[model samples]
Target: MILPFFVYGTLRPGERNHDLFLRGRTLGEEPGRLRGVTLYEGPGYPYAVEEPDGAVSGELVTALPEAYPGLLTALDRLEEYVPGDPRNLYERVVKEVVRDADRAVVRAWVYVAAPAVAARLRARGTPVGGGEWRERR
Candidate 1:
């Protein structure tokens, strides 16, 4: 399914990967929130791990129609996601995110921590408070 992407880490605007990957490819970027996910700090980025009672702040990014294919491939690579790969650090999943503007819930692609990673994080990972990567101390 073709849907907007919910980004919470380096891919968000003003972050390191934004200019390199999404600068000219997105049609729109707006504040959004993904429920039932906890944000955790990675080495230099962040990870969203599924949780029963949590919410993550991010941006819902809509790619330009012509850039969809390439953008999707690039994002997967950036997130180190490989379908069914046990070694993958992240997995691309479809989730509902609420737009900050109008509180409209929309389906979007979300790169979340892979099973093993999520398990590890759940055991000992440091979560970003308030579920906001950018504001993490």
Candidate 2:
């Protein structure tokens, strides 16, 4: 079955990792956003953390049924997420994404940093006020 995913950083279209991980594997893509989160720039990519009223802009993509299995594996590796791992680089979670085109909301999987990691990134990494990785890059 097809699976929906919310990608905010390198996994987004045109980013370095997109072709390697998503490209032909996706059935559809739409501009989307997640509220209550702030985006911060890392060395060559960006990551998001929850915030009081912050909003992060990203893309909502549907994985093709045929590619779903491999896609999920690759994405989990890319995000450095191991099931039940407390020290994961990012936690994969289901969240509501607001489509930018019509303000429609859809449930999708998103990777979010832990609060401590967020705090560290906020203090050390550059804050992307617009909450968009593509725009900042």
Candidate 3:
């Protein structure tokens, strides 16, 4: 549907992956929040796991029309996401994100931890308190 992307962790602005992947490719980036997910620490990154009581702070990134296709593919690769693949680390899904600027609800693509990864994280992964990857300490 070419929806915008909700990025947390290293994909957010000023993060390592931002420059490598999103820089110069997006039309706009703004603060947003994804409800029903918790942020957990992963190897050199962070994963967002579905949790009814949690909310994740991140950015809503709208890619330039021409960049959308490539950006989508690149992100899927970066997140190690393969549709319906059991071994995938993350699964790209569409969700509603609340834009911090206007409190508007926008549908966007979010890469959440895959089923198995989410389960494992739920069992033992360290959650980034406050739901902000950058604020984890």
Every candidate's CA RMSD: 0.6, 1.7, 0.6
Candidate 2 on 1-137: residue-level lDDT in tens? 24499999998888889899988998888999998788988778778887768889889989888889899999999888898887886888888889999998888888998656787886787778688887884
lDDT, candidates in the order shown: 0.95, 0.85, 0.95
Q: What is the lDDT of residue 14 in candidate 1?
A: 86
Q: Which pairs of residues have clashing backbones in candidate 3?
A: none
Alpha carbon lDDT at 93, candidate 3: 96
What is the clash count for each candidate, in the order shown? 0, 0, 0
Residue range with the least summed lDDT across 10 consecutive positions in model 3:
128-137
Cα miss at 39, model 1 (Å)? 0.5
**What is the TM-score (0 to 1) of candidate 2?**
0.91
Q: What is the C-alpha lDDT profile of model 3 across 1-137, one tens digit per residue?
A: 99999999998888999999999999999999999999999999999999999999999999999999999999999998889899999999999999999999999999999999999999999999999998875
lDDT of 1 by residue, 80-125 (tens): 8889999999999999999999999999999999999999999999
Error of 3 at 24 (Å): 0.9
| Candidate 2 Cα outliers beyond 4 Å, as residue runs | none
